[model samples]
Target chain A: MFVRLSAALLAMAVLATAGSANAQSLTGSGKLLLTGGVSQIEGAAGGGLTPWAVIGGYGSARQIGANVYATDVNTTDFDIRSTGVLIGLYDRVELSYSRQAFNTQDVGTALGLGQNYTINQDTLGIKVKVLGDAVLDQDRWWPQVSVGAQFKKNDKAALVTALGARRGKDTDYYISATKLYLARGILLNGTLRSTRANQYGILGFGGMDDKRHTQFEGSAAWLINRKLAIGAEVRTKPDNLAIAKEGAAFDVFAAYAASKNISLTIAYADLGHVVTRRQTGLYASLQVGF
Target chain B: MTFIALALLLAAAPVPGQPGAATTPVIATDGKLFAEFGGREGLVKIVDDMFVNVDADPRINTFFEPAKREQTKARLVEQFCVVLGGGCTYTGKDMKAAHKNLGIQKADFNALVENLQKAMDKNGVPFSAQNKLLAALAPQHRDVVEKPAY
Candidate 1:
């Protein structure tokens, strides 16, 4: 029921803004192309791996915007799929919800579980702009900043706890700063995240170490044109699980805005060791919005 | 590793507002960018077309309604020319003075920028070149916009 309602709202936002002759209407799509970053893996508006400071959709100040996205990531031994909906209000506050499914594939059978065992998790997020303008304030050295939090819950509570996870539910907090060098066609973002999620909470939060750790994530992108951008992102992760050792994540991506209402992102992602072996694979995402 | 290299390369690019560089708003000094903008004649056409867009744009048309069209166009052309290193002089009032009491908001400023981008696109200006001009003008928001987005 909630999914249907969110879909209806997203469709309405697109239809209402699309037919308008003037983009400056009260609920108009006035922002420039590609300024609103694409949806991240966890459903925030940003790069494929990390969230940026920009709002989710094209709607500028005094307007409302929303989007729906589907993302898929396939590694040699696993498959991860995520889908979500997001809403940006007056470009000041953003709310989002996403669901992720992690397929363990043959690795599950090796661990005495059935093949293709899946762990499903849901995340709810909110972000508030703190200061500056990432797009319009191109002249200032200071970047736009935002604070956000994501509350997550995994369905496989018993299995994850058996695998040395402390809890199946937790919250991750982060602050992100994003800036665009308009003249040089460059965009840079830095985020500091406090989290205890092991394997992004798929293996559940905090294993032997039950304390949250601060981590850094960064992205640098070059705008090839108005509709196209190529970039790279690096995200540091915590090794809180005693069962597995983890490493930082890295990806190089290309995002293309086919039109005002749709965008596609493709990337080569290296997630380091998931559980047993080093995992690397292809990541793709599709976003549709106002 | 490749991501780090790419990021380093991008960060090493020339930054604006460096202390030693000449304080002028002009980005290019070699006249190459002026040629890319098709020189003074091209600027005239871009300014003219931008006004056409502005007039039809209800969001910001009211702001332009009080100004003299020809005078504003000429001043804009001169300002653009100076920014592009065309060696032109801008004789009009400073951005703060000209926009005083106009009640310009962030949305209105962005509207004008969109119109200008359309004009430049219509005039066949390269996207990167258009951004250079915009980057030079972007700082003027501090003076031109009276109402904050917050």
Candidate 2:
């Protein structure tokens, strides 16, 4: 899929330059912003199989100015995914929606239950820019800052109730703050996410008595050049469900912005599970906006 | 004996290299910076990229869409080249004189700057050189850009 997209993009680039006879004379301000990175604050959200930071935000391109993306997360026994889209209004405000699909393994065999289990959830988000430009304002001490929120809703009662869950469907809200500091050549981002969902269980885990989870995520990216970036992210996740005892995860990744239309990212992740295992993967995506 | 030795050592020095360092000639001039930026050819590429950027931008697209791209590009090239001390003559009005009525806002100026940066990056211009050019043009902001740029 990516190969075809790349071919198409290259073709367009060639066609754009083919008619050189009366080439347009130089005019206006000519600038292009490049965007691509490997990890999203250690797994906050990206293009990884599970949806990381790479695909979620209005990336660093100047043309489209704003964008939104969605994808699915597939694991061994079940499939989870998210779909969302965002629009950039006046290059300032962005509104988005993301739906999460939680597919549970067959209940009869895995949990001694009567039937198969599945769940669907949705999260609505909005992000607004409060400060500087991550690309053009290299001289300033301030970084471009944006504040956003996610309102999550879950659907699937029987299975959740059987698992001792509080409510079949509930709302989980979060406030995420992100910034890109260009002068330091480092993009520092942090988010405070407050949610009512259970650790690994999406349907308000631990019943109604469980306190909302407050997580802090931090990520830093070093810009190597206009086209490449390497970064790392550390984030805290809920472990209330006892699905895993891990408190945090860290990931290192490299990203390549092949052009205005294409971007690729790869990362090595450690969720710190039974024996401190390693999860390494690659992500490739194409974004087109006009 | 120490005073005599010190005097002899001081005298042995090469007379302070003719009492002062010779000044080097200024290799770069305002005109040269313009020429080095690919003269008119380079400016043309930048203009093309700028138009593409403006067209893609949703906020300012309406403002630029009505203008003929070719004419706009040609005028901009002449204006910028002349400002940078290039030999070409610009037919456009003075910066402040022309932009006073545009009601250009800060957001519009920022958007334009972003586009310019993109064009420079696409052309593979060194960051230092890009900044040098930008510094030379920074003074125009006072006149070419108006407050409340709608």
Candidate 3:
């Protein structure tokens, strides 16, 4: 299914460019460097841990843009790998798809599941820009705002339910606001999300109860120059599962745009407790945009 | 962490159009920003280089021709000089009046900004100083851009 979807998207991209007068100029007058934020873990354009209001890719208001990214997060007891693709339309709307694989290395053996047990989940996301502009409207006090949703489904439905998860599928809805203070070279974003997803939906959704909770995610970045930005993010998660205690996630990251098309992000991430206690390690991602 | 705290502090810091920075477009009362921009002579060179880039840029070149380029450059320099508190008066028309029939879109506006950034880079202007100028000029889009009628 993933292969078919990827092939269809690739065909669409090729056809769109072929139909344009100049294929190379399809993304004409690209956005300012680093304005289109990097891909988030759930595939939205944002910081490492949370989504921002900015769209993904370098396409300006007049063009269609797309990007493909792969992220790897390695912790003390687990390893997570995510890969995704996204498309942005006229700087107004965004659609994304990501596949996450969570490997429970030694923790799986401890829990009697097995060593190196893996849980796979697929996330489909859509975001719309509702108001304001983060970059151009520097004079305004209000930040750019966007509303988005991520629909996630885990492949191991039976396993997740046996582990106290109520469901193997759910949706996370969020609203994000971002502002870039050009003069001070600072970018700030805040997001409010309503969800029942446990461990970002990999371990399934709603273990304790069926009620959704509103959580907060925030990011603060300092733009060192056109190519580099360093930031930190804090994301509050719902402790829905009864088996293991969950806590807030934190990361300090640096993103570097090698050129108009490629960006690299690296971070030290503390995921609190994925399933085991004190899961923290290195997170790195690479993205290519057009 | 300390960085997040500092960022939050700066986020609440006084920006332009506030009491700390003055309400009007004349933001740099200390002449510090103007010096970083190389003053009037520096503005002239920057504007000239910007025009050269605009002329070469196919996306926005249709709005500017060689015949009116010189006059436009002079007006831009004077306007920028005034904005930077270089002690000059803008003799040119207002933003809306000047761009009345140009049919400028957001893309065009951004393209112009990109060209200006390149020109500033060529002049060795510091990034921070360049952003200060951009912040002051960013509000002009409200008057300059005219949405196309569908």
Runs in model 1 deviating more than 4 A are A1-25, B1-24, B55-63, B100-103, B148-150
Per residue, candidate 1 scores C-alpha lDDT tens digits across A1-290 of: 34773765667566656865774455656677888899998999999989998988877776777888889999989999988888887788888889889999999899888999999999999999867778877666778878899999999999999989999999999888899999999999998888989988999998888988888899999999888999999999998888888888999999999976999999999988899878899999999885
lDDT of 2 by residue, A106-207 (tens): 533565543445567655655555444444444333344445555555676666666566665554433333444443455665555555555334544555
Better of 2 and 3 by TM-score: 3
Cα lDDT listed for each candidate: 0.85, 0.49, 0.85
Query: Which candidate number has the best TM-score?
Result: 3
Clashing pairs in 1: none
Q: What is the lDDT of residue A92 in candidate 2?
A: 49
Error of 1 at A62 (Å): 1.5
How far in Å is the alpha carbon of B31 misplaced in model 2? Answer: 18
